[model samples]
Target: MPGFLLHLGATVMCSHGGQATPTAPFARVTVSGQPVTTLAAPYVIAGCGMPPPPAGNGPCVTGQWLVGATRVFAGGLPVLLQSSTSICVPTGTPMQVVVTQLRVSGV
Candidate 1:
């Protein structure tokens, strides 16, 4: 057995208010098809409602998703623990995003 690292990416829109407005939803990165991290989850919004746009700014845009490194076994080999992050942009009005790439490497 061998150990490897995996990478993933995702894109999502940010939601408005608590009504789940269909604009600017939240983006997330996943592993094995599961939401494990997000940009907005770590931060806190001050207002209850959507905040005003920044002065002299266009539509809001988020930075690319990033994963450092994740340790995973090839078959049943035990490997050192590692970590990684995925990145992507959402599509469509409702937005549908998925992990576009997966890479595995041995440490």
Candidate 2:
């Protein structure tokens, strides 16, 4: 079986409250992994909002994910952006996951 890789790189911004201004977009990501046949098709790239953790993690880090048309072969995925999610970082609050990378294999 041939192995495949996908590289996802992106910049994300987050807002905490409705008062403070949003912070600059950061970088978060995932590396290469197994590939899936389903993902090879030309599917609409959509942002799968941050999923809830096992337990309530206080609204979780406020970030956003965008979709694009790219090939996930056997390498890395780089996702870049200017304004992701919202613009407004609340004071005394911390943002999480500005950017990220995902890898899919086994096609």
Angstrom error at residue 19, model 2: 15
Q: Name model 2 segments beyond 4 Å from true.
A: 1-13, 17-58, 62-64, 68-78, 83-107
Candidate 2 residue lDDT tens string, 1-107: 22322223322223322111122211232343312211222212123233335542223333323332243222243222122112111122322334334433332
Shift in Å, residue 105, candidate 1: 18
- Find the 10 residues in a row with the least total lDDT in model 2: 83-92
What lDDT tens digits, residue by residue, belong to model 1 across residues 10-86?
A: 32222322111112222243355633332222212221233334532212233232332234332232222122232
Quote the positional error of residue 43 for candidate 2 in Å.
Answer: 24
TM-score of each: 0.19, 0.20
Relative to the unseen true structure, what is the C-alpha lDDT of residue 24 in candidate 1, on a scale of 0 to 100? 26
Cα error, residue 61 of model 2, in Å, equals 3.2
